[model samples]
Target: MDKHSIEKEFTALIQQYRNVIWKVCYIYAKDRENLNDLYQEAIINLWKGFPKFRKESKPSTWIYRIALNSCITFFRRFSRHPQTLRLTESWDFAYEENVFSSQIQELYALIHCLGNIERALILLWLEEKSYAEIAIITGLSQTNVATKLCRIKEKLKKMSNQ
Candidate 1:
């Protein structure tokens, strides 16, 4: 529709699903600065894509696709550069305290080591999205989603054991 209507609708959509956007970014974030950068990129991508979003899928599904794709792209783009310094320890604990148990926090740490698509698949599974819904967001068949999730879980188990 009009510019105002589009802005209003986009605002409402972002407000309603900001947590989803943040969670996707959080999963990929290396630190606070990276998290902020990923979030900004996701917001810009969402705005650019909103005008063409069809009603063929749920808004959250569309959001997940956009947020995940944006963060993954942003991450890959930055990863090509060499860093002269690195954080000695992850600041993940700062975010996890009082929010998640140690076990869950450890799981998240292991998740960070996963390949980009694997991390996205597990994050969708953890969000309790239906297999069909995840399939739509991930552009995978339902059976493929199920199979990949099974493998991801097993991979997580193996990582956790080590």
Candidate 2:
């Protein structure tokens, strides 16, 4: 494709998958400022990988792989550069309607309580991806995803009761 065509295609793809990027960033980052940084990182990674998209997998799957990888890399870098840490204040969700059932907001708050990147992985797995798909995206086995999810659920339940 020509430069203009490539840019147009990239823009369309970004618009289509923007929600996935934002949601993943929100899950990984503690607050809005970090969320924005993570979101930008994810987008940059997506753009870099666009040319290599072979269509060997579903577009959503490909997008998820890029997003999760970006989050992982961001966390690693952030860990090394602690000076980049920012305030962790909550932001209002743009949509008022429930997206993942009525308890989503509470669930999200509970997720924040977990306070780790692993929670982001578990949340993505629980987003109804098949175990195999989760494994593929996360570079883990189906059994591993299942195991982690079980532990995460127990943690959330325990947190909820507190």
TM-scores for every predicted model: 0.89, 0.81
| lDDT values for all models | 0.85, 0.73
Residue 11, model 1: lDDT of 99
Q: Name the best candidate (by lDDT).
A: 1
RMSD of each: 3.3, 4.2
Q: Estimate, for each residue in 1-162, the C-alpha lDDT of model 2 and write its tens digit.
A: 899998999899889878877777767775657777888999999989999999898888888888878877887877653322212323454322335543666676667556444665676766788888888887888888889888888887887776
lDDT of 2: 0.73
Instruction: Kindly give the stretch of ten consecutive residues in candidate 1 with the minimal lDDT sum.
Output: 81-90
lDDT of candidate model 1 versus the reference: 0.85
Please give the clash total of every predicted structure, in order: 0, 0
Off by over 4 Å in 2: 80-103, 115-117
lDDT of 1 by residue, 53-161 (tens): 9878899999999999998898787796522212133454334224765666677778888888998999999999999999999999999999999999999888777
Best by TM-score: 1
